[model samples]
Target: MQETGSADPFSLSGVIPPTITAFDEDEAVDYDRTAAHARYVVDGGAHGVFPLGTNGEFPLLSGEERDGVVEAVVEEIDDVPVIAGVGAPSTHQTVRHAEHAESVGADGIVVVTPYYYPLDHDAALEHYRTVAESVDLPLYVYHIPSKTGNALSLDTLDALADIENLVGVKDSSKDVPWLAQAIDAHPDLTFLAGSDSLLFPGLEIGCSGMVSAVANVFPELVVDLFEAYEEGDEDRARDLQSEVYDVRDAIKYGSYMAGVKSALPHAGFDAGPLRSPLRLMDEEDEEAMVADLEALDLL
Candidate 1:
């Protein structure tokens, strides 16, 4: 809502990485390395950077830590949009996070739907309306039902599109039909594909951009894919999509959300360890992942 950056915050196109939050061996937030990772992706030709999202381990971080990560990323990357994730189980907490992001100069705020407690359509609409009105920055609804347990129905999206300052939706649902329909229904709202698996299909179906976790490690690969499609080279784009599929499989080894952090070392970045309860890859699994990357000539 606040106009603080040079880049058009609503121009949320191209490849944007949901960057990982770097932690030390002690599992504490490392602000320096966390900012460095944001710089690394932008340097790799990523169009924008999204911190404190799923890959950043937002659920495990304290509100203060989340604010710190946003400040670090906003300071480190001046040219691209930095859309910080500020969603919580409650609207009150989400508004606080959104306010902090705007104050710290984040170009926009991504609010994942309130999780844990199931809500009806009216409750969901009011929740988003409140968050959108609370901030002056562009607000993008993050629809990742698998993790949040609250899926946004098409009818709900229809209502959301009418909210002022509610600019876009990031769909990680992986339900292509649903995503395609949502995009078709709301041409005014920017739609970003939130899964690497749907990057090409998303673009083909009129997605403005992508929020890829794989880009956190191998950004150039994702960037190349996006560029190819934009340049009208369908063959090249499809080829890159195949390559991305391989990369996704290789990096997805071990526990959930662990592959990206574990594979960072191979990409010349150290995102440290996953916070407690989310274990890193074991020796055996890591070696296999390395071999998979090597087989794909990505190592």
Candidate 2:
């Protein structure tokens, strides 16, 4: 981790991919395939690449393997900020991962709130505080209530914002009003929209950018939305936004990573199927996804 002084850790710019992690046919972490996916997205125009994020199957990998992936991606990326996602149910493990990320060349760390069991306000605060204090690098609080069973409440955020190293947040909910209010209340805080379909409306308020899983397959589309908006081309921005929205709808029908992985090969990359318990789609579902992509001429 870069030495954190008074510098702001919140960097909200560009198309950042919560990139897809690939596994070989034997179900091992395919570093080459993972790096290839990262390169493909970056080459397609992503500002940076985030690995081991939720979309990258963070929960599915072992702790040691997670570190390996972070190290490999950092080595491969060279200059792009490789925001490593490092959070766990336990405070000690979370800190350990954060320290490991620091030892490597990770640009930042993304911490998800403890899940599997509900956390009260105090517990959540302590959980984040411990992790934040363990490293000198920027820490991004991940707020995805749908999967975590807990939202990063305003009260919790207020406390976290006080942490010297606490940089920003990645809000995955579709709640733009609440996110805008949060960004307004904390002007120093960098807010990243985690949903691609919400990117245009999000920037209209105060969100810096997005950490989109859809960028795994369509990085240019997401980046264009950001660029057009910045260039004052609202019409072009809306057009790109609509295209990604249509693709987003297709991925939501089933496992998103699985759907995207299936499309990757069609897009001319061999992103194999997902791990166990997250099986490849049945033939019918696969056909449905193909039909949707074909409709958009993406296939």
Candidate 3:
């Protein structure tokens, strides 16, 4: 088994938001607001920060913009670990991002599965192997099949476990059986539940932490849930989980992935606008969402 020390970056636990990339009104990346948001979550008790993940609009931003966001967050956060997302469709591009993340002093890197192309197990192993070999930092495999269209099977995971620097996985698969089985099968690799809906269940099943999108706007709620669980207050943790479900439902009132950006202003920070191709909530939807949040006393 690959032993992970308590001081290792892979020991990351608790709530880590896949932070949203703030953009100006004209849709340019806003580094100031973006870094401020990172500081907000870390100050609110997030264990770490993950910039340029799905919520951060990684695919929408150019490579330069992505590096800028990482640099800004790394510069702002001195206490918490920053695990920048460096996944791309090809091995070449993914390596470049991973190298840049290391160059900028990011604590770790999360590489999502290669997407857009259907890959065989051999191809998948090679892709991860090449990237893992290119960097010295801890590497966490990002398995979000719904978005990536490429899934990592347990057999392939077994192969990946042999890579020296490959330390953990952040699974957004939402398949409890798969997650549980993988956890059971690979005691050497740490697992993080990447979906908000499965936070409690994931903890129950052995996920060391969570990557909650809802944490972007409501870090305390998620952090409280994690702390409650860690402190052995299961009742409070369950209650918080129920509250998270309600918040999640309310956020879905708008377009896909727009809730966090829209709800930011209500939470006292304006992440500006999301890039094109993803729109914000309309007036009616925004009002309804605000009403729900108000009812929950989140506003």
The 0-to-1 C-alpha lDDT of every candidate, in the order given, reads 0.90, 0.81, 0.90
**Rank list by TM-score:** 3, 1, 2
Clashing pairs in 3: none
For each candidate, what TM-score against the reference?
A: 0.96, 0.94, 0.97
* lDDT of each residue in 181-294, candidate 3, tens digit only: 888877667788999999999888888789999999999999999999988898999999999999999999878887999898999999998899998999999999999999
Model 1 Cα lDDT, one tens digit per residue, 90-196 = 99999999999999899999999999999789999999999989989999899999998999899999998888888888899999999888877777777889999
Predict model 3's lDDT versus the native.
0.90
Predicted candidate 3, C-alpha RMSD: 2.0
* Worst ten in a row by lDDT for model 2: 1-10
Best by lDDT: 3
Output the better candidate (1/2) by TM-score.
Answer: 1
lDDT of 2 by residue, 142-256 (tens): 8888888888778778888898888888888777878877887786777778887688887777777788877888887788888998888989988888989898877665664
Better of 1 and 2 by lDDT: 1
Collision pairs in model 1: 1-136, 1-137
